[model samples]
Target: MPLLCHNGRFADTLDPVLAGDNPSFKWGEGLFETMRMAAGEIPLMHLHWARLQQGLTRLGMNDAALQRSVLENILRELALRNECAAAGRLRLHLYREGAGLGFVAEAAPLAAADHGWNERGWSIEVFADARIAPDAYSSLKRANYLPYLLAARRAADTGVDECFLLNAQGNVCDAARGNVFVVRGGIVQTPPLSEGAIDGVLRRHLMSLLAAAGRPVQELGLTMEDLLEAEELFITNAVKGIRWVARFRQRTYAHAVCKELYGLLGQPFNNALVAP
Candidate 1:
């Protein structure tokens, strides 16, 4: 059986530990971070930890017991116990434990990491049934993920690999599971957080990587027409790094730029078990 870490303790199951009255279970009052583990190390842990702290502060959740070193050790131990220490996807969930605003941290192994980039680009479309609001909560990876869940279900039903969600202003916000990026005329552009895009860890890292390489990304609002007109399109997340898009409606994109960018990301992880 797979083991999970709850409040610094290892357990075979969570049922006996988490109560039904827990705020996270009852009303989705919590935050979560999904991280990639490579060579038994979490490379982007600093970014993930920063985001988690920001989320906790934003939600007014008491973070007195949240320590980066402690959480990191727990995740590393959980990965070892799960037999995915070399490469894996891990998740850290923080939720209200009681009425006094205390929180509990749970670490679970998501899966063994896929080290290879996708050869066939992802196929995606816009989810028009609902528009995500451009609010403070939109940027955080909160436990309540109804919008993305519904969009993902629609994509599955329609035979698409992913679905893009738009902001209330009808601008492209982000994808169902990742942040969207477009390449046009050798310029890379992505929706700004002001446009309601999720503050993705990989997105931030990629932007820094690009800027350091003298190819800074432009943060701006993107429309459906912008995607259709782009030379290439891609989505990014912490685990996947970057996934090129082959088809968005009738438009097909080239993967050349995606390949180069993926290599750029992989350079740092060359010595590690998993690369971008």
Candidate 2:
């Protein structure tokens, strides 16, 4: 059986892990981070940690036990317990605990570091049922994930790999499970955080990698029209890295840039260190 680390303790079952009245379960009052583990460590941990801290600060859920070193140790132990220490995906969830906060960390093994990069690209469409509104909480990866959940369901119902969500202004905000990017006129662009896109760790790192390689990405708001006119489209997340979009509506995209960017993501760079 897989073990989960809850408040630094191991539990084989979730029956006693959370109370029935837990705010996170009842009201979705919590935050979480999904991370990629490579060579028994998290390469982009710095960025993930930074985002977690920001979320905690934003939600006023600061707790002394939620220190970086402590959580890192918990995650490492969980990975080891699950026999995924070398390569895996890790998730750290923080929820309200007696007016303060508590955490649960879990890990799952992957075949390799590049396990889920869909080489043939993904087929996606725009989800028009709802609009994501830009807010102080929009960018945080919180437990109140109804919108993305519904979008994911829609993707399944429609037989599409993913769905693009638009902001209240009817502009492309992000994808159901990742950040959206477009390549147009040889310039890469993505919706800014101000437009309600999730502050994805991979998105931020990819922007840095591109800038370092003399291919800076523009943080601009994108529309369906802009997407239709683009040369290529791709989505990003920490675990999957990059997934090119093959078809969006009647438009088809190329993957040359996506391939190059994926290569860039695989290479080691500054601050892309193993979690300490």
Candidate 3:
């Protein structure tokens, strides 16, 4: 099975705008979306597209048709691959240069399953400079991610799974790939959008679900101490879905937040994809 347009149009054969050490690669010129493919189709196609559209516009590269075409092309290609059922990641790369050439890649296998809301957890650390929102513009998930990348790498080196950055005022911001959440007294809380974290689509959906369920949902400022005091803490994204925090620096959380969100999200696939 040849992917839709990947043989002569293959993902492996796809080339980025900069081969050697071009500015974009060197300077982080483009943006990327980490998407999950389940049942051989993107579970939240349009939502991811919406965010990509916003990112393109924020990065001064708006093209609805371009986005759609790249996604359609990749969708076609992925459908042709033999690895659909085994779990995978898709990276849609676009060059900001001339025609905005597209590179759709099918990544190595990922370990993803319905880990149940309350069961999945991750240990995180807080770094001061982990987030570099491309101060040139806003952080549109661009290539310039050395700060966060390096910080996360350091966390891994310290035996932690990931890094959760704090804001200028020492408030817990977000994780490398997902948003952060804290639950105290069974009330769910996350940092406000003004806190300089990427506005995650799935984060919004989860907030709405909690809000509708009458579970406490707060978008207030959260601190490292606030996180430590949380009964349970979790991080979220479209792919990782929801991961609980087992440890952060020297403290360990019981991973109550991980289980709660996971249980909340697993009611159905769309439960994670759509808002309540």
Model 1 ranges with Cα > 4 A deviation: 98-113, 267-276
> Which segments of candidate 3 are over 4 A away from where they belong?
1-8, 11-23, 65-70, 99-101, 112-120, 129-139, 267-276
TM-score of each: 0.91, 0.92, 0.80
lDDT of 3 by residue, 138-228 (tens): 4356666566677778787887778887666666767877888888887888887677666776787788778788875788888777887
Highest-scoring model, TM-score: 2
Query: Worst ten-residue run, lDDT, model 3?
Result: 267-276
Clashing pairs in 2: none
Expressed as tens digits, the lDDT of each residue in 1-276 for candidate 1 is 777777777777544767778888889888888887776788788899889888888998876657788778888888888877767778778887653343343334433233566777899988989888988888999888888989999999999999999999899999998999999998999999999999999999999999998999999999889999999999998876788899999898998888888888873232233333
Q: Count clashing pairs, candidate 1.
A: 0
- The better-scoring model by lDDT among 2 and 3 is 2
Model 1 worst lDDT window (10 residues): 267-276
1-276, model 2: which lDDT tens digit per residue? 899888888988454788889889999989999997766788789999899888888888865547788788888888988988877889888998986788888898753434645756799998878899999999999999888989999999999999999999999999998999999888889999999999999999999988998888999989889999999999998887788999988888898888778777763221132443
RMSD of each: 2.8, 3.9, 4.9
Would you list the clashing residue pairs of candidate 1? none
- How well does model 2 score by local distance difference test? 0.85
* Model 3 lDDT, residue 243, Cα: 71
